[model samples]
Target: MQGITGYELSSRKAEYLKYIHMQGDVVKTTEIAANFSVAPSTATKTLAEIAKAGYIEHTPYHGVRLTPTGTAYARFLVRRHRIVALVLSHYGLEPDEACKEAKKIEPCVSKSLTDRICASLGHPMMSVCGEIEHDCCCCCPSGDHET
Candidate 1:
């Protein structure tokens, strides 16, 4: 949790983090609000909570940036999102549709389950959107997160 959020992350908060990570640098507050279709004030409130958790550095007028820990967690979320999308595709959904559906399922998936999924997906290099990075559990021996 310390490496991820320092506490349990709400699925919505995770999505916000995902968006910030995709931005790849200091992300504008307006961009976050627009991406999530939420009001700027709403984005501000949510971001304030996430920033309080230490996942991002937020400045009132300057937007936000992911902390190193945030980047690590976002990678894991992205991996799960893509993998779940791939699974949805097997059910005849279009890649784009699958990606949408995956969003609903991704946050609930546990790390162990995600590993099983990644394996079954043959450790894919890319999903519909773009690249996928393996999390430590997926890369470590026997799927262990702890060294």
Candidate 2:
């Protein structure tokens, strides 16, 4: 059976997209490799596949940027993952465990399921991993938004 294109994103690709979205502008392959602790060639290969899927634009020797479709999808995934993490936290799991579980489950969940999870969890502003945050908390609690 053929998988639907939009929903066919791998966790690694989704994670890379999330990182780029958070960072904004184009992101270098070397930086992404460093962040994920992978070799640059591996990162390049992964990015090439994503670009072929029309989710990103890869410039040789420069970096990668998300296409409009990629931006929207990445944002949705990030939202789902964070909400799931928060809901898991309420279930007595430690934050780190919740984040791990969220990462594992996020890609398989439908948007409707994510919406329900977010609603049930009271719409959390911070992810259990603490890497993602809602607009209201764009910066660290004690840090300036511009810093």
Candidate 3:
């Protein structure tokens, strides 16, 4: 968290992180490729990049797993996307529509901005997509994201 600025990742890389996080376990390169509709070789190359960035540990024959730092980052990414979608819904977009719009908008949103929006929304507990996890370093006074 110390070194991450929330902007260091490209949208594609961030998407991969989110997917890996959602999996909650080791993910095969072929699985990723299939999900993203890319070639296995393409996923392998991208996974190599992600691994070099310290987000995932990829075993040649096994699969990829997020590192601790990667997990934290992915959590933040999820929080950002949910918060953005929630804000869009407030302005008349439906839940699903807002979620779609958020995918386009969230990558450009910074962590500081996300925290500001979260605070402005009174730190809502649940979002259209899922529960909102608040971190002490941002909007929440309590460090526990679960709360």
TM-score of each: 0.85, 0.76, 0.92
> Would you give me the overall lDDT of model 3?
0.87
Best-fitting candidate, measured by lDDT? 3
lDDT of 2 by residue, 1-147 (tens): 112233667878889988988889999999999999999999999999999988799997999999987777777767777777877888899989998888888778776666555555545556666644333222234532221
Model 1 lDDT per residue over 16-133, tens place: 9989998889998999999999999999999999999888999998999999878777778877788788888889999989998898877778766777877767677677766766
Candidate 3: give the clashing pairs. none
Candidate 2: count the clashes.
Answer: 0
Candidate 3 local lDDT, 1-147, one digit each (tens): 555567978999999999999988999988999999999999999999999999999998788999998898998999899999999999999999999999998989988888888878888878888888775245677653433
Clashing pairs in 1: none
Question: Which runs in model 3 stand beyond 4 Å of their true positions?
Answer: 143-147
Local lDDT at 79 for model 1: 76
Report lDDT (Cα) of residue 106, candidate 2: 78
Clashes of each: 0, 0, 0
Q: Model 3, poorest ten-residue lDDT window?
A: 136-145
- Go through the candidates in order and give each one's C-alpha lDDT: 0.79, 0.75, 0.87
